[model samples]
Target: MGEPLGFNEYSAGKAIVIELKGRFDASVALPVKNRMRSLLDDTPFIIADLGQISFIDSSGLGALLASLRHASRRGGDLRLANMTEKIQQVFALIRLDHVFKIYPDVKSAVQSLKE
Candidate 1:
């Protein structure tokens, strides 16, 4: 019911960078999860840019966890970047900030993957 998610893709060496925008909650988590699941087959490293994500819920957290598991199973990873203060605090409050590799920006996320 809130603003729908926006997706943008970028290439960073061997990593795939994806930017997410809007309310990242139950309203849109499934579709986003499906899309990210598809990338697990071929992509190795992923960076999820969260600069424009205005909100998140448990479902949204599940989607990210699912993606991380999928990627890790295939010896890859899903990193996070550009988190808004709100999103950042939510992640911290949930202790998920330690679960995922977080970067200040997309470039840093991609760079970490390269190293």
Candidate 2:
């Protein structure tokens, strides 16, 4: 099994900032999904901070996409920020880079959601 993923949340006014660390793969996808789902229940905006995310795989990407969809359906918004080069490449390769709103940092991503 892979090491346990770590997630921390901080509220910036009305926006929820979720900082993700460690590797995100199949083993941890469900947990990530559940945590994000719970957070979205009350928050109208979410910014996933990937600055410390060391690795990602297909399952990780799927979890992000699912979160985006869930947030959008509820009239909220989800955005990715500080994605590592590896993860950014995956998004580009899969054409997801164009599908989701991405920002260079958490502040920008959160601000974009408000607009």
Candidate 3:
């Protein structure tokens, strides 16, 4: 088996940072979306830290976009941070970089939500 996907959450003021580790492909996209849905109830500000994400697919990107829409409906936004070069390239290629507010690190992401 491959490395199991993991989530580590951190609270920063009104924003929540969720660190995603391992593959973020089809296998885990549903679960990831479900988890973020529940978290959105607590606060709409969410930051997905992708520094440890080893892989991602279209499903993963869809999950993120869905979560972003959910958050937007709640008058908040979903942010992305700590993306590796490969992940960054993928988002850029897909033009999702314009759809999401991406930061270099979790701290900056959180700070942006404060403003």
Candidate 4:
């Protein structure tokens, strides 16, 4: 609970890579959403690197869906990378694994989106 959800931004061609850290829950969802929204204005491709994410709840999932919808509306896309086992299970349980583009890492995610 003390850990803060944070992200680092990097550029991969036309895509933007966001390396995430800490838990993605109700407390951090809104901040992440706002930060991501700010980036949408600059690039159409967004890669969310969840390598360090330890947990994600319904609120986090909602934020991700919202980001996806927002990106889609702007002719952009949001892809997930380096998903932890816990997060992956949540995606599978909710049948969202098929809905999103998943990659082993940020580089792969960026490369996949370029194709």
Candidate maximizing lDDT: 3
- Local distance difference test scores for all models: 0.87, 0.87, 0.92, 0.88
Which of the two, 3 or 4, has more lDDT? 3
Cα displacement (Å) at residue 77, model 3: 0.6
Considering every candidate listed, which one attains the maximal TM-score?
Answer: 3
Q: Estimate each model's TM-score.
A: 0.94, 0.92, 0.95, 0.94
Clashing pairs in 4: none
TM-score of 4: 0.94
Which pairs, if any, clash in model 1? none
| Candidate rank order under lDDT | 3, 4, 2, 1
Tens-place lDDT digits, model 3, residues 77-103: 999999999888888878999999999
Mind sharing the TM-score for model 1? 0.94
Pick by lDDT: 2 or 4, better one: 4
lDDT of 4 at 20: 86
Candidate 2 achieves a global lDDT of 0.87
Worst 10 residues of 3 by lDDT: 1-10
Residues 1-115, candidate 1: write the lDDT tens digits.
4488788887787787888988888888899888888876668788899998988988999999999998999899999999989888888888999999999998888788657
